[model samples]
Target: MARSAKAVPWFLFAAGGTVIAFILPVMIFITGIAPAIGLFGDALSYETMHAFVGNWLIKLILLGIIVLAAWHAAHRLRVCAHDFGIRADGAVSIVVYGLAAIASAATVVALLMI
Candidate 1:
């Protein structure tokens, strides 16, 4: 019997997440529109920034982004190692996932702390 391979959403979720995360931030900075589009406008203060990000909506957004980003990093690292001709799939996956786990944990913790 032959084994069949199926596409995984996690792979896309991770790759897409990483690309989107970096691109979104850069685009925001370049366009200088995030500030105006964000919760604060005209005069953005530390308090305003904190308050805005502290909202549930912001929390949800951050969580969504970070969760996906972490997953994306894990998958990308695997692909990178594979591309580099690394044959240790188990070790590679473990290391990649470890990074993702740590990053995801930190992101969630940081959000809750704030």
Candidate 2:
């Protein structure tokens, strides 16, 4: 079936944003549970706690949300801007997509460095 032009981006943005909101929180909670629940003679210290949080898996999850949510936020904000007639269509699209792209890039780079 042929999809309408308007439905495409909104579908992607909403799907991505929903997965981020739903699955990612559960993943984060699961990831942290062992540390939070288990206690021992060799219990993790404050520094170790920081390092655990700084691990690659957690970093990746955080980066994913940042990438998805930033775009979602930008798109929503653009729609609101258009609804309010605060800017021309061309300018609004540019501003929204541009910020989303920059946010995505920054998030990926930050994750890579961790």
How high is each candidate's TM-score?
0.70, 0.62
Instruction: Please estimate how well model 1 matches the true structure, expressed as its whole-model Cα lDDT.
Output: 0.72
lDDT of 1 by residue, 1-114 (tens): 664331463655656676676766874673376565674454466676678779988898877766676677677778789899999978987887778778888888988888
Pick by TM-score: which candidate is best?
1
Q: Considering only N, C-alpha and C atoms within 3 Å, which residue pairs clash in candidate 1?
A: 14-72
| Whole-model lDDT per candidate | 0.72, 0.74
- Which stretches of model 1 miss by more than 4 angstroms? 1-15, 18-23, 26-42
Tens digit of per-residue lDDT, candidate 2, span 14-69:
96689777876776665566457764423466676567758889887777777777
Say which candidate scores most in lDDT.
Answer: 2
